[model samples]
Every structure is written in C-alpha cells, then in structure tokens.
Target chain A: MKKMLAGYDAVAEAVKACDPDVIPAYPITPQTDIVERISEMIADGELTSEYVRVDSEFNAASTAIGASAAGARIFTATCSQGLKLMSEPIFSASGMRLPLVLGIANRSLSAPLSIWGDHTDTFAERDGGMIQFYAEDVQEAMDNIALAYRVAEDKDILLPALSCLDGFILTHVQEKVDTFTQREMKEFLPERDPVHTLDPSNPTTMGAYARPEHWTETRYEVQRAVKRSKDKIGEAVEEFADVFGREYGLEHNGLLETYRTEDADVIIVALGSVCGTIRYVIDEYREKGEKVGLVKPRVYRPFPAEELNKVLGDAEAIAVMEKDVSLGYQGGLAIDLKSALYSNGSRIPVLNYIVGLAGRDVTKDVIKKVVEETKEMRGKDPSDIGLEEEERWEPLREELLPGDKDD
Target chain B: MKQIRIHGRGGQGSVTMASMLAKAAFETGKESQGFPSFGVERLGAPIEAFVRIDNKKITDRSQVYNPDIVIVQDSSLLKLVDVEKGLKEGGMIIVNSSEGPGDLDLETDAEIVTVNATDIAMKHLGRPIMNTALCGAFAKATGLVDRESMARVIKETFEGEIGEKNVKAMSEAYEVC
Candidate 1:
C-alpha cells in the first residue's frame, strides 16, 4: 500500500522487515525517531529483536559488534557526537570484518554543539575502513538500508557498511515511501550466511591478538578486503536495480549520477541532500538556456575517482559545494573531487563553494548563483578566484537581535 | 505543480503538518512530497517544512521557492525568518495567530488568511500545539487538499482519545478560518 511515511519511519520499517537480530542505539536528535520507532516496534511485539538500549554511542557500536560477531544481523544509528563517540568501535567493526549495517544521520561535529545537517561527522570517520553510501532523499534512505545489508553480508566482501543521510534534512522529511514486504525484501536482499560467526558449535577463536610479527600482513589483508568491497558495492547496487526497478550504479551509477551534464560547460558537483537542490537549480538554469548540470557522487568512501574523471572530462569548469569544512584545507568533498581529477591529469578548473551548514537552507537561487559564479570564473585566473568567501554562505537568520527577544 | 512552506519550531509539528497535507493531497489522487529543514535539535528553535503537490510525480527535490501558499505555525517566525520571501504574487499566507489577515505587521502582496489556531487547539485539544489546526486552516484557505481527506488522514494518524480531540480541533479551525 502507498503510505505517507516520514524518512526516519520508513527506515525503521525497512529495518524491521530485514529482521535484524540485534539493534543497539543511543538517542540523538534527528536520529532519535528512528531508534525510538525501532525500540517501540520491539516493545509492541511488532518486531522480535534484541533491542539493546546502550548507555552511550560507544556502547551502541560495541554491542552491535559483539552481536554481529556472535552471528546475528545487527543494526545501529547515530549522529554527530554519537558517531564520534562510536569511532573506535566503528574501526573495530571493520577490522574484525563483521558484516554490520549502520544508519548514520550525518550531522555537524560539536564544539559549538550544532545538531544540524552537515558532513563533518561522517567525514571525520573517512578512514574508519567502512564503506559509506549517501542517500539523496527518503526513498533512497529506505532502499539503501536493504542494499547495505546485502552488500555487507557478501562473503567475499565481509565488511561493515554505513548508509548516511543528511541528519534532519532527509531524516525528518516526510515523503511517499514504498515499503517492501517481507517476501519482496527477502527476494531483494540475500539471507545472511556469515563468513565467520562466534559459533560455540564450531569453537573458533575470534579477534585474537596478532603479534607484531604477523600484525602487518593481517592489516594488509584487511586493506585488501576493503578494496574488494568497492566491487561488491557495485555488484550489489546493480543487483538491487535489477530486482527493484531502481539502478544505483556501482562503477557508473554507483559512483556518480550526472544530470544534464553531457553538453553543459559548467557542472556543479555535490553529495547528499544538496544534490537534490542542485538538480532543481540546474533545471531552472536549463530553462533559461544555460548549459548547467550537476554531478552527484553516491559513494563517498571508496571515492569514485574513475567515474568522476570520465563524467567531468568535457566540462570547462566544475564547482564543488561541501557542507563540512576541512579547516585549513578545501572542503572535504572539494578536496576529494580535486584528488580524483588530479590523478587523471586533468587541468579542469575546480572551484570550491561551501554552503549550507548547521541546517542552513540551500535554495535553488543559491545554486543558480554558484553556476553563475563558475561561468564568470571561466576566463579568470585560478589565483584571482577565491573559493572561500563569506558571500557563499547562506544567511541563517534574516534579523539578528542584539538583546533577548524572549520578553 | 504547487509548493507550500510551513514554518514553526522543533516540537511544534511543522513536519507533521507537512506530512498530513501531503497525505491529504495523495488521498485526492495527486502526487505530493514533504520534507523539513532543521538544526537547533532543541524544542523551541525555529524550523521549516516544505510540501510539493502536482498532477504528475515531482522529480525536483528542492526547497519550495516561489511557493504558491505559505503556512506559518507561529507568528513570531515572521520577525525571525523571511517567511514571505518567495511567495508567489497573489498567493495565500495562512498564519496561526489571533490577528486578522491585515492585522499582521508585515508587508506582503499576497492574500493573507489568519486564524487563531492556538486558541482553537487549546479549546478543543487543550494544548498550544497548532500544527494540525493550522493545517486545517491551510486547507480551507488554499483548497490544495479537501477538508474531508485531511480529516481521514488525521483520524488514521492519531489514536483513540487524541484523534477525537484533534478532529474537533480541525473542524473548528476549518469553520472559523
């Protein structure tokens, strides 16, 4: 039945259908609804799962690790600070080669303690050895949950996976979502026959300490497994498209989704929910007879280098918009895009435009401006064009009060 | 295609209102999408939710700029956010306040429809959360979704006692607004 489902509820329902044996979560804004729904589903007997309400995000991840290692399909969700707290176990989940799936609501890292939409929290774990797939909207968020499980459980690529969505941007959005029935989900996602499990029947040693003599090779083998996971991700997305009438290309569709960029001279590259805005802006510009397009990267972890280089081969200028800052460096997505193009020996001028952080709105007009700026920078010197500027930032509040307005 | 933006706070149910409106539109056999933009992660911080309804499926997923209708769940958001920034000329502005349409202290070229949804909600539901009541007012003003479809969705969403009170609140809001 067609139901109006909020993004978070859709995810929770998909998780329930997947029938994960263990669920460990810590409550965080934007992501709280997902965990709360899951917990309630378990409590109401709608879902029969080991609902582990952990004291902290770290414990949440640890619990998932232990459960997965003990041969159960495990699930967890976190955002911003919660993700940071779970960083150590995230790496452990990867290192131990546990086939775990995590629903990550991407939020800004704290200091100022902003619980808004941003890539800082996810980008911080870039080196955590987990494969990451970003969903553009609520539908993808639900689809990716199922796909992540399938890809992670592939024996040849037994590694953890993360399905990341813009914290409140996509998570809290209510949209028409088609939930899969158990029969449909079973057909879409292969049942788990874990490569390694804490089977008391088998009596195997797990996560045993490797001495320095053999530790280096063990680390190398883990690296090899991660590299192999890229291929598995592509295959899984392809299989999902075939089964569900949706194609998330691995080598081609998996890496990037280019919209109206074939004949366009200016292309804007972005990820996550902002890609949706860029697509809207591109349509508007196209209506005005401007050759503007958008290239959205779907896979952020393995860094879709080959696909991006090919898609951007003909573009005159590429504008990269990132929600997370790289501090002294270019924005995270910008840096990755630059590296991808650099390896191809392409001298295409790539401009970095950072917009929409802390839940700031990225409207179509802002995207149009970025395209206009990229066109204006066509003949200008790279040194003359400054990527970092205050004007690029979207204004959060129209009126700033000097005193308290609460009275 | 028509887009609508709802402005409120974190716990104020702007997202819920957006979803209900979309559901109402869907029940009428139209394609609709609703989403929210938020960050404060706290109770009272300002938040915004958007809805797009069309005869055809909406492929564009962007914030509703040049909205055909604007629904303000809180009047205070007017001073904080540019609520009328991209309002279409002659579009409708439905605010949940005690003030009349022209009573609002703002400049707008659109048709304004104001309802004291807070009073209606409190009178019926005994709470100040005006999302569902404002949604009823929005439906009455814009006619984007029929009141009957909205009531059905509301009944299905809320349970037992709360559902009865919210239905009363919505009916009162529709009558006055």
Candidate 2:
C-alpha cells in the first residue's frame, strides 16, 4: 500500500514485511530511526522477531553472525563509526557464508566528526565479501531490503548483503512509498532454509582456520561466490518486478539502470540519492536540446561492468559523480568506472566529479558544471583531461581553503 | 514543484511542521516531500526544514534554495537567519508574530503575513508552541492546502485531547489570519 513515510520508517516496514527471525542492531544516527521502528513493531506485537539489544555495532554484527549460523534469518543496521566498529565481524560473516541483511545508512567517516550522509563507509568495505546495493530513493530503499534478503539467502549466494541508503538525504526525507503486504512478501521471499547450520548436538566446524593449503582455495571460493551472485541478484530483481509489479530497472538489467541514454552523448554515472538531482538537471539540459542522460548503479558490489558498458559504449563522454573520495585517488565510482570501461576495451573520456561530501548540498549548479566540463572532453585525449596535479574539487571555495589558485 | 522552507527553534517543531504540511498536501492528492536541514540541532537553537509539493514525483533532493513560501514559527529567528533569503519575488511569508508586516522590516519583494500563533496556542493548547497555529495560518494564507485536510492530518498526528486542542488553536489562528 502507498503511504507517506520517512525513508527509515519505510525500510523498517519492508523489514517487517520480510519478517526476519532475529534482529540484532545498535542505534546510530540516521540508522537509529529504522531500528527504532522495528523495536516498536516488536513491542506492539505486530512482529514476533527476537530483537537483540546489543552494546555496540560490533556486538550487533557478531550476534547476527551467530544467529544466522544457527539457521535464523537476521537483520541489523549501522553507519560510519558504527560500521567501522562492525567491519571485523562483517568480514567474518561473509567468510563464514552467513546470509543476512545489513542496512547501512551510508554516512561519512570522521577525523572531524560529521553525522551527515556519504558513501565513504560503504566503499571502505568494498574488499569485504558482501553484496552491496545502493538505493536512489525511499521506494528503492524499501524494495532493496527484500531484494537483498532474497539474494543473500539463495543457497548459491550465501553471503551477507548491505542495503545502503544515504543518511539524511534519503533516511530522513519523507516521500510516498509503496510497501508490499506480508502475504506478497512471503510469496516472493520464503523462509530461509539454510544449507548449513549450527546445531549444538551435532556441531560442525564453520569458518575454521585455513592453513596455507586451504587458505587460497577458501578465499578463492568466496571470490567465486560473489562473482556468481551477480546472476542471483538479477534473478531476484526480476522476481521482485513480477511480484510487486514495479519495474525498478526498466529496459535495462537490474544491475545498472539507464535514464534517457538512448541517444545521449554525455551520460553522468552516479549512485544513491544524487541521481535524482542529476535527473532534474538532465531535464533542464534536455530543454536546451542537449542530450544528457544518467546511469544509476543499483547494485554496486558485483560492479555491473559489462552491463554499464553496453549502455555507455556509444556516449561521447562519461562523467562519474560520487559522494566519497578515495583520498589520494579519485572517487571510488570513478576509479571503478575507468577500470571497468578500460577492461571492456572502451576508452571513452571519463570525467570524475567528487561532490556532496559530508552532506554538502549538490545542487543543479554542480551537476550543470559537471556536464559543461564533460562536454569539453568529447573529442579530447583521455590522458589530457585529468592532467592537473591536484584533484578537481567541483564547487570548491578556494578562499576557504589555503590554496594559491585564484579562480 | 512548489518549494517551501520553514524556520524555527529546535524544540518548536519546525521539522514536524514541514512533515505535517507535506502530509496534508499528500492527503489532498498531491505528491510531497519533507526533510530537515543537515545541521546538528539542539533545543532552542535555530533550525530549518523544507517541503516540496507537486503534481508529479518530487525527485530533486537538494536543499530548498529558492522557496515559493517561507514559514517562520519563531519570529525571533529573524535576527539570526535570513528567513527571506532566496524567497521568490511574488512569494509569501507566514510568520508567527503579533507585529504587522511593516514592523518586521524584512527586506524582500515577497509579501509577508503575520498570525499571532503564540497567543492562539497559549489560549487553546496552554503552551507556547506555534507549529500547529502557524500551520493553520499557512493554510489560510496560501490556500495550497485546505483547512479540513490540515485538521485531519493534525488530528492523525496528535491523537486524543491534545489533537483536539491543537485543532482548536489552528482553527482560531485560521479565523484571525
């Protein structure tokens, strides 16, 4: 049913519809609202899940791992410092092949503390063996909760998954979301039947120590599993469309959704909530007869390289806009985009724009500037575009930073 | 899309005002969105919230830089914030104050309307909170949302005796405004 709901509340509703057996999560900004709603649902007798109150995010993930090992479907959430604290157990969860859903209200990491939204926390754990899905808005965020659980619990793809929503941008924003009924959700995602479980009477070793002989093979198996989960992700997305009757990834695969890219020359690639602003800007440019389009990555972990190339191959230039920077390198999406496209043998001029860090507003002006800069790279040598010594900080205030360059 | 920005103290329910306005608009068959400022809010500190209403899906997630309407729940925020900043030329401002528009001395081409929401709230709800009263004034002044829908949303949000009292304050403020 369609209801006006906050992003967090919507995700919590989705979680309730999925009805996990156990929920072990600690409170953190942005993410706090989601867990709070679940707590209320459990308290009001609307849900019967075992809500585990943990001391920290570390215990949250550890408890999730233990519960999932005992054949209980699990759900938990955290962000930024909380995610950093939970990283160790998260990796362990993946290595142990425990399938559970982890909700991440994507927030910026801190030396200088900030409680705002960004993708730094999610990208920091890119190496961790878990599936990642980035949502564009509240509806997608809600849908992805079910999708993540569906894909995670597949007997073939028994890996932890993250349903990431931008902190305040989507988490706090209120919008109309169409949530599924529990009956529909149960049809789409049935109760988990684990391939392996921890029974005290007949205890079997899981995530055991790997020696030199077994270490390489075991890690390779995880790598292979993640690689194989891409198809499972696609299948789940298709099934979701059949059940919910909403095609999240229309005309394109569920991995990378393309917006108005049929004949566009400059296509901006983005993840999460910024895609909405880019779509607005694209409409503005379209009014002026500029063929601008957008490609939003719904699935980030399997990286959607081949699917992205199919839609982006004909574009004159590509601009990658992201909320997190890799510090010494370009934004994570840009780095991944370049590598992905290059491997596909498409040497398109790709412009990397680092924007909206720590909840800084990425307005239409920033997106327009990206398009203008990307337009300049249409026929230029790819090597000549980013020749400047320093990274390009779009919409940067030179006066505030102690920089010599005067604009 | 019609954009709106609300300014108030942290404890005064500015965010709640934004969300309620959006919900009212949604009740009237319009798509709406509401979100709070990125600032870390503390009680009594100034904070801002935004609302957008349209016929179609509201996709632009950027903070409202140009609002067609601005609502000031705490008139004291005038000294600290440019509540009129980026207001459209022919837009409107609904402020919670007993003073006339000329006395507020805000430098803007937009029209300013005042409702003594504090007095109305104190009379009906026995509190100084002006969110419900200001929302009533906002509905009466702009006509973007009807009083009936606003009252329904207000009642849906705050139940029992408190809801009826807020609706009373709202109706009184609406009458005066």
Q: Point out the worst 10-residue segment of candidate 1 chain A by lDDT.
A: A389-398
Model 2 stretches with alpha carbons more than 4 Å out: A386-391, A403-407
Q: Please write out the lDDT profile of model 1 over residues A1-407, one tens digit for every residue.
A: 57788778988998998899999988998799999999989999999999988899999999999888988998899889888898988787777888889898888887887877788888888887787889888888888888889878878777788889888778877767777888878887867888777877888876678899988886787778777767777777787777777776554746668889889889998888888768767887899998998888887877778788888888888898878777877688888887778678877778887777876777777777778778986655444555555224443354764766786
Lowest lDDT sum, 10 consecutive residues, model 2 chain B, at B102-111
Docking class of 1: acceptable
Kindly list the per-residue Cα lDDT of model 2 for residues A1-407, writing each as its tens digit: 88799999999999999999999979999799999999999999999999999999999999999999999999999999999999998898888899979899999899788999889999999999889999999999999999999989999889999999999999999899898998889889989999989998988989879889888887888898898888887788788888999777744558878888999999999999999988999998999999999999998897888888889999989999988898877888888888889888887999888889888899999899999989998976567765573246777887787766575
> Candidate 2 clashing pairs?
none
The best candidate by lDDT is 2
The TM-score leader among the candidates is: 2
DockQ for candidate 1, please give it: 0.49
Note the Cα lDDT for every prediction shown: 0.82, 0.90
